[model samples]
Structure formats: C-alpha cells, structure tokens
Target: MTASYVFSVRFRLSPDAAVSVEPETFETTLYRPADPPGEDGWLFFRDNLWRGEVNDQRHARRLAEDALGVDVEAVEFRRFETDREHYDALKAAIADDLATFNADSVSEVLNKYFGSSVEVVS
Candidate 1:
C-alpha cells in the first residue's frame, strides 16, 4: 500500500548561479510519500497543510527545493493519493484526535485540513 502527497512547485534559477539560456522559471509536479495514518510522521499533513493547499508556503518551498534540487519559488498541495485502507485509517485517526482539532466529526476535520483533495486510488 503506497500513498503520496502531490504538489505543484514553481522553480526559478538561483541568481548567483551561472545559467546558459538565461534564468527562467517553471512549474513541476512533486510527489512525497505518505506514512500510514496510525504510523509515525502521519501528522505531516496536519502540520503543513490546510484547506487543500500548503499552509506554510515558505516551509513547503524549502522542502520542494530540497527534493527537486532547484530553487522553488512557490509550492501548492494538489492532493493525497492513496488506497482505501489508508483513507479509512485516516478517518479513524482523525476521529481519535477529534478533540485536538476541535471539530465535531471526522468529515469536518478532513475538510479543515485536506478539503476535497483526498483521492482514494486502487
């Protein structure tokens, strides 16, 4: 069972670095694996994402830059692609921590953090 978080990243050449065709900016898709909901590191989305996008843009940009080996000017979360097991597990986890989120239900919590960006795959 593999799951990943997708993000759209915009990158620009570092000004100090020499470039051949002149400094240019471009956008690319980035994927980061997601841990199981009950496992360590599962709170990554909660800490870094909100409302279907990257809640902390600067932090997300740095992460994207590190992963892509480019200077990321911006980063936006696209979605979380996972299997049904992961989605169910996430719901269970969210239910357990409902008080922490101050939400009345799992759906509300999911909306608050992930919005409509959760995609259950095969």
Candidate 2:
C-alpha cells in the first residue's frame, strides 16, 4: 500500500518583461514508489530545482530521513499542488534534498527550495 502526506514549496519569481510584475505562486508533489523499499520515485516540482542527477531523488529522501528522524520508508511527498507554471522546475528543486523528509527537517528543506512558498496542510 502507498502512504501519503501533504507537502508544498513556496518561492518568488520575476515575471516576464510584458507580464505582471508580481511573482506567481507555484508548487507540486514529490511522489515516490511506495511498493518497493529502495526504488526511486518521481518528483513533481519545477525546472529550476532539477539538477539532472539520477540520484537526486534518493539524495532528497536520505536528507528527509536524517532531518526528520523518521524511517525512510515511512515518508513520502503527497497531495502536491501550486498556483503557477513551472511544475517541473519545482519538482526538480525538491529532488535536490529528497533524503530529508522527516518531521524535523522536511519543512526546512521545503523552505530552502521554495523560500516562503512551500506549506504543509493537514
């Protein structure tokens, strides 16, 4: 069975030359394969966050476990969403620190990647 949780990332961005000057809200979900213990999962964020590393997801997962003090197998990024474009970019950003998804440091990781744009809803 798949276990899930709510996670979000917040960040600022400059609008296009002709677009509005206000930064748009954006976010996404960091989905992992829940069946297997060590299988890599798909991260849904933005392009700015993607580092083109195959192990990026694994790294983030590890970080989450370290920071949260929770079992790596017990956590997953779930029910993700945003109010702007660049979905892939946001996912990439989260992937940078996938390993740190515990109760302690997951918030920090999200804040680092999304600034104030990330949030966790019950």
Candidate 3:
C-alpha cells in the first residue's frame, strides 16, 4: 500500500508590508505510490485548504506572499505519517468541515482539507 502523510508549512511575512498580516500556514495530504516510486509527488485532489494549488515549498511561499502582499521571510515544513491513530484523531477534529465535502474516507477528508497541493515523499 502507498504511504500517506500530512504536510504542513508555516510562513513568516516581512514586516514592511502594507497590510497587517498574520503568520500563514497550510496543510495537505500526500500519497506515495509504491510502484515506479523514484520520488513521491503531489496528488491533485479537488478539496484543499487554499482551494488552489500549493504543492511545494516554492508554491507555498508564493501563495503566502501573494495573500499577504509581503515578502516571505522564512518557511518551515512539518510532515507526519497518517497512521490509523493520527488519521482517526484528525478525522474527528475536522469532522464538521469534512461534512461539507461529503467525505467518507480519510483520503477524501484530507483532500478537502488540503486540495491539490498535497505532496508525497518516501
């Protein structure tokens, strides 16, 4: 079976921006296939946090800059395997949001949470 993971990134914005900005954060789900598995890649699911693509570090940085109208000072990414326990907890925590997407599975809920920007790594 493919390995599943949750990916999250935290971004700090430049201080000189015109708009008052808060730290930007995003999360996504990644699916790593076992076959032809040279490097894990993104899974473009319809449902996601930004509702647009935020696949990689560069994309996340760009999104933050664009949304905040400021340069990105730093970005930190955190990833964790979506083992059964973690998945269950996540599902419960986001249960209300998942209902909006009509998601019945963990993958579907993750897709709704992270959209097309989901990344995969081995």
| Candidate 3: C-alpha lDDT | 0.43
Candidate 1 residue 13 C-alpha distance from true site, Å: 2.7
Tens digit of per-residue lDDT, candidate 3, span 19-80: 76554433333232212112232222222233433335576557546755655543333333
Candidate 1: tens digits of C-alpha lDDT, residues 1-122: 67899998889876555644454788888989998887899889889999898998899998888888888889989999999988888889989889878899999988998999999999
Q: What TM-score should be assigned to candidate 2?
A: 0.24
Could you tell which candidate, 2 or 3, scores higher by TM-score? 3
Tell me which of candidates 1 and 2 scores higher on TM-score.
Answer: 1
Put the candidates in TM-score order, highest first.
Answer: 1, 3, 2
Separate clash counts for every candidate:
0, 33, 3
- Which regions of candidate 1 are displaced past 4 Å? 15-19
Worst 10-residue lDDT window, candidate 2: 46-55
Better of 2 and 3 by lDDT: 3
Model 2 ranges off by over 4 Å: 21-35, 38-122
1-122, model 2: which lDDT tens digit per residue? 23322433232345568877442533343443222222344333322232222225555546555654433432333343342332434445445556644323544555544445443333
